[model samples]
Target chain A: MIVIGSESRGSVPNTSPNVRDMAQVSCCQLDEEEFRKCCLQLLQRSEELRDGWSWQQPQGSEDGYLKKTTLRCVSVTSKRSKKNQQDSALLIDSDCRQNQSAHVSAAPEEATDDADDEDVADDADVPACSACESSFLQFEYHVVFSCSYSSPVLYFRAFTLEGRSLTLEEVWSSIHPNFRLHLQENPLNAVSQQEHPLLGQPFFLLHPCRTEEFMKPLLQMAQQHHRSVNYVLSWLSIIGPVVGLHVPLQYFSTVCVKDPASSSNPG
Target chain B: MIMNNDKDVLRDVWFGRIPSCFTLNSDEVTEREAEPYYLMLPRVSYLTLVTDKVKKHFLKAMRTDEVEEMWFEYEGTPLKWHYPIGVLFDLHASASALPWSIIVHFKSFPDRDLLHCPTNSVIEAHFMSSIKEADVLKHKSQVVNDMQKKDHKQLWMGLQNDKFDQFWAMNRKLMEYSTEEGGFRYIPFRIYQTTGDKPFIQKLFRPVSPQGNPHTLCDLLKEMYPAALTNDGEQKRYQVLIHGIEPLLETPLQWLSEHLSHPDNFLHICIVPVPTD
Candidate 1:
């Protein structure tokens, strides 16, 4: 089941090896709606608690074993990028104002998840020599979408204040230090350059499968404890870094998520 | 599959070897009670094949008048009669060119003193002395002619001292031979470990590479888990213990072979998460 390398010997042409491994797990028997329902149910409670991440239910027929849930972490844009965004933003103010409705649904945590998609459709229309002066470009939309197979695959793209798509290479270079560990070794998973299956756009797929072995115990702990103490926050703290999604560690002080299993013991 | 060669069981660690059953207090038994007859068995015994129906051919070969039922012990655990002899060595000892120094205990002598066998310390001493004796064979057959005075003194001194630490540090070099001696001159040794509770077997390389670069037990962890190299992941490094003592990551594998690597039990790979403090 070699997936990413030159020798991709997976039996299904579209199915990757990671997805196949996920399919082989005992949890694969769970249907798409139930799968999405279970994961979102956990995060939905966390969201009500204002946990580090926000969840979105799948929109259409793209679910497999579960209605793939989406997790997003919003980060503020760098000051320099903000300045550049503002300069270019005024030039395209008309377009930026047109998509204010879509921007409202972005990062609920930041209360400031900025950016109006001024030019979401066209990459070629913008001139090369000019600077991007989009005024509202202050948010980084980091999202990971789950698959029907219960595998969490990434779907991410960043935009400027004027709504210009940031190059996948830019996102690669700007990966958080906590997430840099994966990028430094066999970095192909760092920013896997692939076309978004749904958006029909080029985007980086931060592979979460690398941590498959690392997360098994966490999942087992969740099940063995009957219910996690704070399963959603614990899950995001462990997984958010793998895909370059920045969920601040400060929110999870003692990391009591692993407590679910340890809590089972009376001793 | 049944294999006659003990080396095959010794080195093929991917599947892991079944452990030896011999249980006892110490590795070497210095004193022994005289049995009816002292029978020196073959250096290596691997009789898994069955004859006609119920009789085992290999065990039958080692039979004597008083040898009602032959068995061996380590520490104090009794070796199982059902398993083959080759696998017994594989379970207890590292793969080596040197023949095993084991004693055959007959069941007939119930109340008498048992036959003594080589312990880890005794095995280590025998190998050290054997190499010294062989050194005399080189440079010329005239004993001690090829062996220099300094080399001769160090060998006997290390042997008599019974200081496993320093003796093995010096002798592992003798165990290795370059291409000049011929291809494949090193002893094949392996250790087993489990990551957390997930048990898996993996091969540990000799401390020195063919080019002579020093390697460590840490190297074994690195080759197995590439993620261990990172700052955040470095904490995932395995903690190896031969008995209960944790061997230092910097210590050479050859030293472990002499002092800690036991034939009776597999080495444990201890997994403990890095303390945040």
Candidate 2:
């Protein structure tokens, strides 16, 4: 029973004015300026993340204005759920072949077996035979700051190697079952295709209205422990996995350094 | 009397109409030439929610196999169905000749440019999400969170059915604020500009200043978008529009948020270049 957004604000125990001011400074939410600074820091550190993600500012915009960070063509593998497999067999058999061929060039070893199975299972109960097998998917992820919510939002879209976009149902099927169950329970956290605010392109985004609700506890815990955590990294670690964008452990090790203020506290 | 004036402004904003002509894209393979569909689009309503007639009108001349999810484009740019009709018109075609000529497509739905509104339920969900977001800004979600499921539904139904009284019955509660607090915690608004690829400008702007003076629209523009305002003696380059009309710069932000906000409860302001001619 997770209360979302400002509804949960009243339930939390009241803190002293000093603590409240601390919470305001160390709160999970970021203003546009803080979001931009954190994004620049994330790009500067984390060499691996840097390879995948790039900051994109719209042309003819002044410096220090709105910009989106993008990570493109991240490959993911997920075992197709039984229902999705059945639907794919009936609806996209030919499309699967084209995608499989494209995947072969990208990953020859894994795609070969899957491609062979897809060819044979065209008329069979493919779900039963290839239940354990996985499908290769390419996903593009964008981290855009939502001004209304004052939070960074994850907008991503999954596509086949052949370039056909996955519908929302197909995306839901690809989610890790653990996160999928949680997302299913909370309708606000559900992923839906929305127009990319900057590009005006259609991309699937997890609703950001409740981001502060979910991130608050994690941030509060860190604040209490005197751990200075990167807002973008911590926030991304929570949400990235839901959409199959796993944050690498190297990111934490490489980028996060203890703050000088927190250094006085003994481990 | 102030309440009466506010009610009148809300009604005018709700009932504002843009007469539009939706023409089928010339490239669409049709059994017969499709006639251009014409309708007076409700300013506060979503394009996809209100364009069923336009879809049906064009579908008559097209083969069932050739039709895909219907999409609308103005000039060359694909119109996002998620935005309110008035926002789209004001941003792209404000100074254009009327009835606004919109190109409709049945094939090759631009997957990149537009979100798919497969059913009215999608629009409902989007609409409800927007109202909740606005409430989060206005009352810290207190007013809307206190609402029952039916109250939420009534708000949606009112907008969907175009029943002004039914909507205001549920909506007036959302627009409420304690007199001691002056107005909403923050004014829920989005400033749209036609020039850039940037979607829109949104930030936490309060209706009243810290000193308790009521902030005007000019104050918001000055803080969020200084360029939209002309410097002393400079030629006016932009026209700031809300519901196809420009309110005075001196209008209080709180009054505008209450009266001019769409059913979703966000004051959508569009800044379009003034006609050079």
On TM-score, the candidate that comes out on top is 2
How far residue B257's Cα lies from its native spot in candidate 2, in Å, is 0.6
Candidate 2: give the TM-score of chain A: 0.61
> For every model in order, what is the number of clashing pairs?
27, 0
Model 2 misplaced stretches (Cα beyond 4 Å): A1-28, A48-51, A62-135, A254-267
TM-score of candidate 2 relative to the true fold:
0.80
Docking class of 2: acceptable
Worst 10-residue stretch by lDDT in candidate 2 chain A? A92-101
- For each candidate, the alpha-carbon lDDT, in order, equals 0.35, 0.72
Give lDDT tens digits, candidate 1, residues A176-255.
Answer: 55556656674423554443433323445655434344556766776888753343334455665544344445445544
Clashes in model 2: which pairs? Answer: none
DockQ of each candidate relative to the true complex? 0.01, 0.26
